[model samples]
Target chain A: MRFISQTSSDGVTEQLFTLPATSGDIPGVLWTPDGATGTRPLILVGHGGGQHKQAPGVVAQAHRLVTECGFAVAAVDAPAHGGRPRSTEHDRLIGEMRGRMQAGGDVAPVLAELHALIAGQSVPEWRAVVTALQELDHVGAGPVGYRGLSLGCALGVPFVAAEPRVRAAVLGLHGAETSAEAAARITVPVEFLVQWDDELVPRATSLALFEALGSTEKTLHANPGRHGAVPEFELDSAVRFFTRHLS
Target chain B: MRFISQTSSDGVTEQLFTLPATSGDIPGVLWTPDGATGTRPLILVGHGGGQHKQAPGVVAQAHRLVTECGFAVAAVDAPAHGGRPRSTEHDRLIGEMRGRMQAGGDVAPVLAELHALIAGQSVPEWRAVVTALQELDHVGAGPVGYRGLSLGCALGVPFVAAEPRVRAAVLGLHGAETSAEAAARITVPVEFLVQWDDELVPRATSLALFEALGSTEKTLHANPGRHGAVPEFELDSAVRFFTRHLS
Candidate 1:
């Protein structure tokens, strides 16, 4: 991993970085409080699909973690998304899915394939980044936590399951057998946020994912609305959750 | 709805029945003790994917419900499986899924689509069967329960959710957004069974589905094995669950 540039704003130091991986060059941003002094807990913030590492929500989350919680935050662009060259196959498959759905065709196979394609590459890249971060003396050996929503949950589940560095996570917006299996391996404290009537994700799927967490101390915070409408209070709770567990 | 035939064997009286629906003639069987008289609790058993109403497991469960639990049992073939005429679309999709997987392709979208296709037809058909059964004075309207494993759980989740007659259910071996959503609508008592290392169904998915159940009184029976290796002890417990909740 190599730092590309650094910018300072509102007592937050933001640095752009890139990690060379088999998948490609993974670009990301790391946020730290100005004069953060010694090592502090590192919170990895993940973004939703169609969004990048510095998506407004992700940036806000990083800002909050550094300013309010006094924790460093990091986020990387998922492969085939944000700052990465798009795959022709990925675009073709997505087009095929839309066409098939419109034609009243079965599309589960394609969705599964897409998940596998992205996750197969994304999880490993995240792990490499985590390893690289751990080697930095200033980043500390303190606890690490992850917070991702939707697509982030999809990627974070497996990533956290495989990375021992992640001691706690705030995840939700996606659930499946694969994610559930990954969740079963997560014995860390977890805070799951669910949108009760999420248009894309059924409530049961989210609930089931929450139930699958191996953590003895996991909490489910559900609110009413569509996929993107997770209440701000829930976000606050997640921040507190990370603070309580990681700090 | 019409009864096709009635046969008595092993102290259990089996009546093959059919219900006409938009999908086609829905074939089913109802089992009761040979000497059963008056109205007893009724258990609606659901068979799994690729299996018919009289699959060995389904039959055994019916037999147990009638002979041991002293309750009536009923089940029907899901659309495109068993006695039902297989759809060209379903066949084509299955072939496509197989081909895709063999080619190292993702198949989640296809799986989801296939599930939606069957559940779309199966849930409504089950609801219709429930209505038809309720009209039969001989069937009696005592508390009703459901028993389905694997594919059965997939069908039963939505079936039980929509059919208010189902006061209790034995559901597991499948977890998805559709099942989860349907599970959230269920308020009846439930006893869920899980195969820990189910090759087809992940343990996390099963656990999540169990957690999603809206029933206030729910029991989870987990065993060590694959999808088809549900232990006999769990079956015995399900019979007791029906006896307690329905009888």
Candidate 2:
């Protein structure tokens, strides 16, 4: 891992970095308390589709976790998002999804295909990110958590299922179509969110995904809203959830 | 309203009281911070089936709201519950429900019938109780919240729908079979709980009840457990929910 830039504000230190990977170097960002010296619980946030490591929502959540819970936070660009290069296959799938959505056709099949494609590469990338981040002085592996929704959740299910380092997760805004088998393998405590009137994902599929989770401690929080309109109180709940498990 | 007894412990003041009604005196209990002065948010908790105003769960929730949030909390015995007298109709319904369950028959119809019978009286009783309690110096007309599940929810659905004083509610553990129309009339913020493996209420019906609620701000919290096994964390969530809307 190589640090590219560093800045501090509101008692949180933000650092931009890159980790060498088999495909190429992966761009990422980390947040920690200003002048931190000891290891702390680390939270890895995965941004939604078309969003990057430093999306507004991701940054806000990272800051809150750092300032309120005193945890280190990190986010990495997914395979074809952020500053990463997209393959011809990525372009083809994106074009097909956009065309179908514009025609008012069901996008579930395309979404599942897109997620499967991304997860194959992103899962191992996430594992490597956890290993690299944990080795840092201020982010030593005390415990790790994951926060993701939408496209993030689509990729997160398999990652959390395969990665034992993740002790807990807050995931949702996706469906069971692509992730049910992976979700069934996850046993850590999970908080799954669902938008009751979600336009992109079918409500039944979201509920089905929650039902498919193997975690004995999973909780579903469904709010009345569209795909992007999760209520603010849920963020507070997620903070308490991670604090309970990781702290 | 007449105070029958008063006690103080752990910084929470508990008072037992009864309100005069046409049928009889409606028994109730109230909790507030010791030496509390001025009007504050009040939460009325309706105990589950077979439980009373001072049931362990009811008392624990009341004390937490009082001590932690400095809110006044109250609960009253439902019709045919606690110290209230059960009519021949109540006896018949109870007998039928128990017999159906023992014989491995579906109990939803019987339970619904029982709830309908009880709610007819309890809804008006709850309104009178709220009117009487809010007249107290410490309780005075303030934003009121309601918490109830199972039979309490069956009764609460209609009560909260009709009582404009109730600004918010946490209700679940029953189904829409008997309360869908009433639920559609409730417009306040609500937190609905669902026990994923509930033995008494079918999961689909619980989801249907949540779906039937007309509140734009309603949220559903589903945990992996049976009807009687709501996790302790939900109580904490409820406290925050009331505090957010009330205070």
Name the top lDDT candidate: 2
The digit string of per-residue lDDT tens for model 2 on A85-190 reads 9999999999999999999998888878888999999999999999999999999978999999999999999999999999999999999998999999999999
Predicted candidate 1 versus true structure: per-residue lDDT over B17-134, tens digit per residue:
9988988999999888886767778888888777898989889888888888778888898888887787889998788889988987876677667878888898888878777776
Q: Where does candidate 2 clash, by residue pair?
A: none
lDDT of 1 by residue, A220-247 (tens): 5555568998766556667777887888
The list of candidate 2 runs beyond 4 A from truth reads: none
Which parts of model 1 have CA positions greater than 4 angstroms off? A100-108, B1-247
Model 1 clash tally, residue pairs = 15
TM-score of chain B of each: 0.93, 0.99
Report how closely model 1 matches the true complex, as a DockQ value: 0.02
Against the true structure, candidate 1 has what lDDT? 0.80
